[model samples]
Target chain A: MERQPVQRISKRALTLWRIYGGIQFSILLLISIGLVVATVLWEWPWWITAVAAALLLIDAVVFIWIVPGLRWKRWRYEVTEQDIDLQYGIFIITRTLVPMVRVQHVDTEQGPLLRKFKLSTISISTAATIHKIPALDEREAERLRQSISSLARVAEDDV
Target chain B: MYEPKRLHPISSVINFVKTLKDAALPLLLVFVLNGNIFSGDVDWIPLLIWIGVLFLVLISGVIRWLRFSYWMEEGELRIEYGFIFRKKRYIPVDRIQSLDFSEGIFHRPLNLVKVSVETAGSTGSQNAEAELTAIRREEAKELETLIFQEKSGYVSTGEEADDADIEAAQSPREKVYGMDMKDIVLMAITSGGAGVVLSGVIAFFSQIMDNLPIGKIYDEILDWIQIGVLVVAFTAFVVLLIAYAISIVLTIFRYANFAVYLEADDLIITRGWLEKKQMTIPINRIQGIRIDENLIRQPMGYASVTLISAGGSVLKNDEHQLRMLPMIKKNEIQKVLKMILSDYQMVDEFKQPPSRSKYRYMIRHSWLGFLAAVPVSIFFFPYGLLSISAGIFLVFLGGMAYRDAGWNAYDTQLTLRSRIIIKQTYLMKKHRVQAASGIQTLFQKRADLSSVKLTLTSGGGAAVAQCHYLEEKDVSHILNWYLSSRREEKPAES
Candidate 1:
């Protein structure tokens, strides 16, 4: 296989992803509590509460504990003068190459959550597709965006 | 040309007819909803209201045609239109890409054409910037010449310059390809149009059932079936045959007199019998070429070629315009393609995937069907066990897909062929590809297999061409082939 892109996304992305997972787990916990209350009030079957509890446990383990770490390890990207190379995905590893000439624009976006963590997502757009490197340090994202835009200006082609 | 010109008076009639066609389905439903007029059970109040609405629509069409005016002013195509809103749209001549002309039955009789103004700014929009419902053919040609001169910034110095303009307008177009009646018939017969028509018929019946008294119909059908189930089945068979015949006739009408012509830098396609259409696609706008061979067409040695183009909203509205060669003998594609796009080459020899990948292809295609079959068999018991045949059929299809999956890189061109029911082969240039990717699943990584995918811009969106489950080396080879383009161009430019 070809060598994977060298640069990795910010390590803080793992914590951000885990926090997102925590929010989802909290929602599931609320639903499980509701199921337990229903089992008591309506005298419903006990298995329903048991199933909800098992689902909440699995959700906590998979989303909050496992997926974020593996995803952080898998994500890598490298931007050169000639092209942008991205290696991402957990189970199905995908590596993409977008030539500099085809880069239409680059944008750095930050949501309220990401802003609080001092992180931003940089998206590189071509005429055909958009590739996003999520959760980069705010300053690093700005630097990369400027460099990519300059490189893209140097290389020109028709759509 | 500076003066605002009104279209031929026939435009009002054409506009009325066009509006009527758009509202035909709703009008039909309205008529059917009322009691049968033939049985003298018609509701007069709704009928009167419908007549009043029709009159209003007719008046609006006339007003719209009367208000619409177009002129060339200050290097822009200026159009002022609308009855109530009074909108004025000025499209710069430089932004105008091409002008498409089509003729409906009404326009044909009046010797008029409907001109659509295509602009690059209208890329993702569904409609063109402007349209002239009906204009004299000669007038349309003159307008095209005027716009061309304005775009090229040509100043007419004298009568000699005007003479040259006339000469250029009369330049001969080389006929690249044309479909004869026999091939059109063959294409119509082999097309999957019957299935579409069958589904449409089913949908129409279901819609009618929702509005009408279905219980009464059910009682009548059940009574008929009680007499003889064979009779009911025979009637259904006849309905299917009729639907198939209707679809065949529709296809023949749509594709009749299809011909391709090569203008200076444009591929001009003119097709249709009753409602004629003419589309002009710039040569440079074409990103790649795709050849499709459906199961039936492949066995019959026939295929269709579709041009993957990057611009033109005219193509976005009617995708049929993208089908440069709607139907042709498989062997004739090369001869015809050479006349049009000589840079692209059709490679016969391709590096196929290893034999070991066959089982992977089979599993990829049939796994979902097998999973579904297990649940179905458990639920329906003996009857649902028959669903296993579907999984077996899918496995057979997967074997076909594997047999056909192959890729070849020649010079700057890359051809990737794969199948998912209809076999598609994409011929893309190195520079035309916007992005490329190589994907490997966890299981495939252990097996040292990867899939190569490339994207080409087509009509404001990306068209992806992929070949699944190939050797790791072959996948890298394709990726390297794409990556090498930058290095090769850098030295050449320096």
Candidate 2:
């Protein structure tokens, strides 16, 4: 068996994640503001509002300034004739292997954000779960899905 | 065979009981509101209203029974049923996945059976795509046989074809195991259903409490709760004990006459007292067999065997991933495993984690318990020494988890024994394993340790077995176990 070659998601994924992170932080900011208002008007515990604001600040910093870069660096995937391996997560660094024979089907998807960046996400489904290869170039995503399905069929036939 | 047939008249009664069971919660709520909140007196107006409601429900039940008709037409089982609105569904005999025969208390006296029809793609409230509330047992049997005969003709490739071979073997009908009273008690006490049943018991009792003379008694008990601390603790302990006893009794009655038999290429599991459920799972469709032991069961040296079957024998939300043996002695686990699935056997030697892995395991397992103790320790700072003992005990539990956690790969099936609060020993075949991987955490990487995870395709979901804090090389070996199978033998047929 050859050593499985691992590949990373598109570099543009970092920019897309930044935008996604910005949206998330805005929601958190709104919730934090509401908590502050409740604390002032309703005479809620000062500590409650303080804790909420502190947590939101930490979250915003991590999401807007840190996580996207770390997540992009950590996300690596390899699809072989035998299996699909996905390595992800910042703190955990999880490596998951999905055997080709168990692959029921594969699909390439695009949302407004991903489509805008010329990137697509491919989801590989088995009987139980859907494993995703996120943010590949549109053409590359299609090619991967085609090759994976063909390989999966061959594996299925062998079984 | 082309002629349509109606459900037995007894089906109206069964449907009535079903409606009552479904409407039980609302009925109880209404009764409680009328009795307690509305007025103290029980008057004729409410009684008349209740009677009228029952009459309407009974009429609907009768209408449903009158409308429902099924028959074999064009070699397909065509069923048409509706009270106000009618729809028809025809299922090809070859596509019928499994035919289940059940007899609740209502159907038992009449010698009638409830038939549930499952297909390859059944996604509904109840897993069964279609059901016949009441039919003759012999008629259900004939229908099942007829479908099987037709199904075998076209579906004779994998599992169904193997059943054809087992037809010759069916005559003997070997009795594999039967649960005795001792085993029943052991299983009942060890059953994890206590949590689910306990809540149900509380709900039932609370509803009863609202209307009964026991209301004043519960009020006095609540008065005692105002005393707080020791009273609360004592009450909680008593309630827990009562719940445990009730759950055990419930389990014993539920699995009263548990028995297993191998007929052809299918294993037949029969259990329950009030509601007898008979399920037949094709042996070939079984994706994996698991020997599971939770916290309570493990301490008593008992483990249960559950089968994971794909694309067949679905009943009630669960029972599809049915328990083959509820509780057997830990030592007897391997014996039972071999008896049921012969291609694999248990191993005496397991791949143990490194000695230092114990410390990591202790920290990982005990952190939550430790965090919980922090509050108690803070609140009772003047007598905070009381909380230190709990912390120490939790630490000891973590050590025990480390002692328990290990892995063993025997031929193709990997048996992993891992402990958190609950000690679970999971077994899965290499081929059945859908995925496997190894991860190295920042701490683990620095310590030259890695964790392994194995994912198996379970009934409608994925079950994962993971071992944390192992030698990097060992973790890698665990990852490759699925891909490197050399002795992956098919389970021996009975």
Candidate 3:
């Protein structure tokens, strides 16, 4: 049998996605501040007010920038003719490999946001794990879905 | 064919009586508390009411005791039960998971044991279930042996090979993993801090009225104490902290001697010092594995393993659908996991983390939780500082949630790791997933990100594990993986 080459996933739109996430996190921070102010005005103790506000601010900043950076650093996935390879982590990187023959089903879904953006999410489910690709354009998602389904169908016949 | 022995019919009454005795304390307490709270004018009436209720309960219990009867006919286990409503449930011999025989301290004198047969059913309708309160010990053992032999035979014949094949195909039994007593003790001792705190609060409130100083200038003194409440509050806080620690210690002591064993295709767990329970889980029924690392366990390199199963019965107190393994070291996880799942391989080598952009949706996910907390805090403002504190906690929790969101997928496997205080990694195989779903809220649509969920079946039912927000190209790749066909089996690689 010929050994297959490892395929790497695309990283084209990741930076834009990260920036959007940061903006959403900033909005959360604003909401947290509003909550703290409302609480402090309602006769809460200064210590409680201070702690809550600080935690929320810390949380928002961490969510916006730090978390996304960690995730991006960890995310790596590859698909071959016989198997799929996924590697990801922020601090503790982990790798997993699943054979093509084990796939039980495949599905594609679009939420309101993805719909507006003309994007869809693809999900691959095996007996043990559910792997996903998020934010693909409509045509790309559909094409990938067709290819995977064909592959899965062929795999099923062999099983 | 072996002749099936007939069980003594009187055992049903004894079991019903035992059940009544176990239920009596709570029922009596409810009546007493209600009487004390309601009917202050006539105390004797309340006493009479209690007597009347007790008398009725006794009569009903006796009737139920007389009504229950079970027998094994051919390859079927049959039970005729109920007092007012008669029910007959017949279960085939093959459907029985295990027939358990137990003897209470009281039943020992009578040489009697209780017999319970468990089956694979998620609805928890105890249809193929029967409890023989006090049957002869010899008879109980005979029944157990009969069921065990049947199971052993079925297993030997490769009928139970769905589970056994996984174990046999993967590795040797010695190489399979499981937890020891030390791990169980560590898990119980360090894991239940929140439960300890909650129990302390309940204990304090229950005894609060007894401790309060009543009469004359009590109201005046209370007012003064409220003014200097900060000092008093500090003292109270210290006391509560001590109480919490004690409760935690007591809880650990009470739960000592816990053990988990991986025997062939079964995961057997035994725990509790006073009221010991033995639970046997079939490997095939395990829906998924959840590896959780809390702040306390992370430092020790320990992670708790929880098995998600649809067949197990619910515990009486909490509605937790998953059974926790308590604590095990990260390095030891693979060994223990192999015992439960023989065919699955553990990917021990670390790969480079995914690009940072994968976390964008996690931050967005946290905002939804924060958004929900704002209005709730405003509505409960009258509770003063407590309500405000709760609001703050929610926002903090949401922030922590963002820090925890991340996903990792390998060739045919995917793992979604997330947490706030308690971290969890959901592991599954791509080919075994039964369904996939994509969802997005209106706001998420504008962000061009959507949530992808995949459903996988274990035994009879399914579970959906998800990843939120990824780029369009990534979604396509994942979908392609799912739709991709299986390849022929290659030579096994170590």
Give the number of the best model, judged by lDDT.
1
lDDT of 3 by residue, B462-481 (tens): 56565555443454455556
For B256-283, candidate 1 gives per-residue lDDT tens digits of 9999999988899999999999998878
Q: Which candidate leads the pack in TM-score?
A: 1
Q: What DockQ, between 0 and 1, does each candidate earn?
A: 0.56, 0.45, 0.05
Q: Interface RMSD for each candidate model?
A: 3.5, 5.6, 12.3
Candidate 1 local lDDT, A58-91, one digit each (tens): 9999998999999999999999898899999999
Cα lDDT tens digits for candidate 2, A47-127: 998898788888878997799999999898888787788888888877788878778788899999999999999998776
Candidate ordering by TM-score (highest first): 1, 2, 3
Model 2 interface CAPRI class: acceptable
Instruction: By DockQ, rank the candidates, best first.
Output: 1, 2, 3
Clashing pairs in 1: none
DockQ of 2: 0.45
Q: Which candidate number has the best DockQ?
A: 1
- The CA lDDT of each predicted structure is 0.87, 0.75, 0.57
Instruction: Write down the RMSD of candidate 2 (Cα, Å).
Output: 5.3
TM-score against truth, every candidate = 0.92, 0.84, 0.59
